[model samples]
Target: MRIKTLLVALAALVVSSFAVAADYYVDITNRTGYTIYYMYVSPGKSKSWEEDVLGNDVLMNGDTQRVTLTGYTNPYFDIRLVDEDEDSYTFWNVDVSTQDIVVTLDHLD
Candidate 1:
């Protein structure tokens, strides 16, 4: 019976760990002096960008948007933003779990 209890407890711990993986959100503030038409975020190890987080919406300059990144365990991400002039700005290997992300002209790649 003790062995069975220990196994159950271990299983519960593993399940809880997975449940808390990347189950958080962060705010993305736009300070680049342009309208952001598209935004993409992918895992740091990924080779391509994920779907647009804006989804037909626009983030004008001086605006902030909350981006929820749930179900992903990876803390590092690659963020890309497209402006009204079709200019692309990329920020690589950003830790999106600890704090909000603020993008400005200085972030241009």
Candidate 2:
């Protein structure tokens, strides 16, 4: 009976660990001539909020960087890339529910 209890507890612990959410990584590259001021990522179908602003150091030409998010549960995400000239390039309404926990971006401006 003790052995069975131990096995059950071990199984519970393993299942609990899997229940925890995962973190995701996003890589951004600056292909544009201008420097990017900031970027944002937010939850499903909601108006983009400033709180989600990812203050990446001014991304210059051919520069690349990565951002990590933990316990993100949004079905839809929006990315706004802002330039020094106040020009914003918006990648709107992306569904990431099925995407891997790790997200990598290349030259996504």
Root mean square deviation (Cα) for candidate 1: 3.1
Superposed model 1: Cα runs more than 4 Å off: 1-20
Worst 10 residues of 2 by lDDT: 99-108
Query: What C-alpha lDDT do the candidate models reach, one value each?
Result: 0.88, 0.62
- Candidate 1 local Cα displacement, residue 89, angstroms: 1.5
Looking at model 1, which ten-residue stretch has the lowest summed lDDT? Answer: 17-26
The root-mean-square deviation over C-alpha atoms between each candidate and the true structure, in angstroms, is 3.1, 6.5
lDDT of 2 at 80: 75
> TM-score for every candidate vs. truth?
0.78, 0.59
Q: Which stretches of candidate 2 lie over 4 Å from their true place?
A: 1-20, 52-56, 95-109
Clashes of each: 0, 0
What lDDT tens digits, residue by residue, belong to model 1 across residues 1-109? 9999999999999988774565667688999999999999888899999999999999999999998888888788888999998888888888877767899998876
